[model samples]
Target: MKELYDTISLQFTLKDFHQQKPNLAFATAEKQQLIALLTYMRDVHRYTHLVFVTAVDWLEENRFQITYMLHNYDIKADFGIRVMLDRDKPVMESIHHLWEQGRVYQRELHEMFGIDFPGSPGVNEPMILEGWQGPPVMRRDFDTAKYSLETYDHRPRDTREPESHMKEKLYPED
Candidate 1:
């Protein structure tokens, strides 16, 4: 891994080595160089499969972590690449050329997490949450209970129901 990585030699850290699958994580401080690394991984190291692309929302930090998982079938090894996006303006270049499956992953991320892949077609289209009208649900700050109550019609709950139920259950011995 080190010899192959040294060829392109963009500064990246070995994030984990002891796990069942070793992983090297790259921070997106140099986002442009990431594509180059992916190309080398695919063409040279033969990590030809793009397993997945996904996002994680960190509400406190106001950032999103985007991960790209690539698999090298010949060696049975999986590699991960990570990039952080500003939650307010979550956009990144798409890896559509390297792997066609990236379109679906990007599109789903856009719908669920509000991340955008400008270069990937259909990324903005509704995929999973076909008619979703609320803010991105996957974001940590999204209040799902609030959205559900407001979006869908349901019978109002009794305000005293919780108190009565708790009194009966906790004091059953009484």
Candidate 2:
């Protein structure tokens, strides 16, 4: 892992790099260099399988972290590439060319996190929250309780003890 890291470090300008486990590591790079870095990893490092693409809403830091998890079957290792995007304008380059499944993840991130992958197919279309007019619910600032209360109809709870309710059901004559 260290040797692989060293090799990558020499080629790309990584902001941060750390090993989570013997076989798993993560590296953060600038958004501008993300596509190139990923390309190099896929081409040179043989990290051919793209396991997943996900995002973290760093509300306090005013940024969004997009992570791409890649796996190398031959080496039995996993590598993650992280890129931080401006919270105000969360945009990232689409990796659909390298991995076709990237489009699905990009579309999901676009809907859930409001991130933009300009060339990602069907990115503008809704994934889960179809025909919805609300803020991105996955964002930290999105008040889920408030949205639920406002958007959904609520009914008062039935205030009854479970034991008594069971007793009533068991002994109906009483």
Candidate 3:
């Protein structure tokens, strides 16, 4: 970890989440420096496996925090690369070069959080949820319960039955 810190010390800030272990994270000092930082980690540190990518909607800060978790089996260390994007503009370059699975992660985040991966292939395609319309529903700004109430009829919990076929067969209810 210190080796990486020493290399990009000027372009990135190395953060140790805690003192107990060397679990390290690097936050690019500038958005433009993110690709360079990620490339350094992949080529030099051998953190080849991109476990996952996700984003957090920082409503109060009006920004989205994107994190990429990478693992190096040889060194047995996890390296995280983080970038913050403006909530309104929420776009970043794709790290598909480092790991192919990144395409799917980018697509999901783009759908749910409305973050864009500018150069990624198939990133704009629909993923799990489909045929729906609106601003990213997972954004902190989107009120899910409110939207559900407004769009669909609500039923009281007490008035709803379990409706389980197994329960009927096992109990033989009257």
List, residue by residue over 50-168, the lDDT tens digit for candidate 1.
88888888889988988788788886777667777787888888888888888999889889998888989888789978788888888888888988888789997766688878988
Better TM-score candidate (1, 2): 2
lDDT against the true structure, each candidate: 0.75, 0.91, 0.78
Candidate 3, which segments miss by more than 4 Å at Cα? 10-20, 24-29, 157-174
Answer with 2 or 3, whichever has the higher TM-score: 2
**Candidate 2: where is the Cα deviation over 4 Å?**
160-174
Residue 30, candidate 1: alpha-carbon lDDT? 44
C-alpha RMSD between model 2 and the true structure: 2.9
Whose lDDT is greatest here? 2
lDDT (C-alpha) at residue 151 in model 2: 83
**Mind giving the per-residue lDDT tens digits that candidate 2 earns over 1-174?**
878888888878885789999999998888888889889989888999999999999999999999999999999999998999999988899999989999999999998999999998889999899887888879999999998999899998889899999999999899
Native-structure RMSD, model 1: 5.2
Instruction: Please provide, for model 3 over 1-174, each residue's C-alpha lDDT reduced to its tens digit, 9 standing for 90 to 100.
Output: 756566667556654432225865544345677777777778877887888888899999999988887778897877666778999898888888768888899999989998999889998888977876877988988999888999899876754346765577678965
Output candidate 3 Cα RMSD: 6.1
The lDDT of model 1 is 0.75
The lDDT, on a scale of 0 to 1, for candidate 3 is 0.78
